[model samples]
Target: MAEVLFYHLTESRLEEALPDLLEKCLARGWRVVVQTSDPERRDALDHHLWTYRDDSFLPHGTDADSSGALQPILLTAEGAQDANDPQVRFLVDGAEPAGDLSRYVRAIYMFDGHDPERLAGARRRWTIDKAAGHDLAYWQQSEDRRWVRKG
Candidate 1:
């Protein structure tokens, strides 16, 4: 079964949290696709990733970029995805799960816990995914800013 993980963001914002998660995926030799809610968010994230840290860099490109298939990590908004045939997918900004989950080794949903709509959406997805029989895990950040599995 495909594995699905839910990330509840209460202590940190997306811009502060995403790059670190993407780095972990890269370290595992897994190609990644980060799907945001809209083109603006995707573009914004594209810029953020480039300048997130002075000492570090994430090798990523958007779907519109040349040689998108060659990028280890790809950024795309809703309706565009998997340009590099990634093994892992990250859904942020209220983006929903893919129809065919089996294609991915793992799928993650990261939502802002402080947003009522996002929290409700996460609950909805949790119910749907659980009913669909995909292996699901929940993660929430601890007081020390470390992710701890909640379920």
Candidate 2:
């Protein structure tokens, strides 16, 4: 069974919170795939990952990149994201979870907490993933802006 995490983005932007999470996944030697709803979102994230910080670098490539198979992190759209054989998958910007949960060690669904639609979507996903028997955790911003897992 895959470990599924739902990250409620309230205090931080997706661009701000995502790179650090991706860095942690890389530190664990896990190949990652960041799946977006569309190619435009994928390209935008691809650009942000490269320049998110001046002092840091996250080595990643896109599905469109020739070296997708060799990348530590692969940013892709809804179609055929298995090119990198990712161990971890991050679903962002309203992207739905990839159907084959067993293929991934961990799957993260990140959504904007301030958006009513996103919040409802997360709730719907929670119910589905729970029914599917995934070990689930929901993380939301605390008073101090740290992640606090809630029931």
Candidate 3:
């Protein structure tokens, strides 16, 4: 089974949660692919957080146009459709349509707070309808982390 781990941000700020998430993914040896609606924030993360095996940080958005030590492909939703190369695994962080989740074999749908209705709605639209031959895990963070198998 494909493992999907959703991380629901409890803190109002995303900065507080980023470090832990990055550390966890690195420790697990997972190559992360982040999709965000905010291009500036996404560029910031690409600039600061991501590191290649060469120990060089990836460059910001369009600056990564060239293939080099600093160029990690920062794909938007449209770019993601053509990204069929098996060399990378994705860690999408945005909403459904923005993430272009159909490309991924497995996905973790992360959400904040106590809103099962919202979760259910997403399930009905995405996982139940679009995601076939894939496993999706729904996770929420509150007093502690909890997850349930969705699709």
| Cα TM-score of candidate 2 | 0.95
Whose TM-score is higher: candidate 1's or candidate 3's? 1
lDDT at residue 40 of model 1 (Cα atoms) = 86
lDDT of 1 by residue, 1-151 (tens): 6799999998999999899999999999999999888888989999999999999999999987877899999888854477798999999999875576768899899999999999999999889888878899999998787899999
TM-score (all chains, Cα) for each model: 0.96, 0.95, 0.52
Off by over 4 Å in 3: 47-93, 97-106, 114-121, 124-126, 129-131, 144-151
Q: RMSD, model 2, all Cα superposed?
A: 1.1
Error of 3 at 92 (Å): 5.4
Q: Report residue 130 deviation for candidate 1 (angstroms).
A: 1.1
Clashes of each: 0, 0, 1
The reply for model 2, stretches above 4 Å from the true place, is none
**Candidate 2 residue pairs in backbone clash:** none
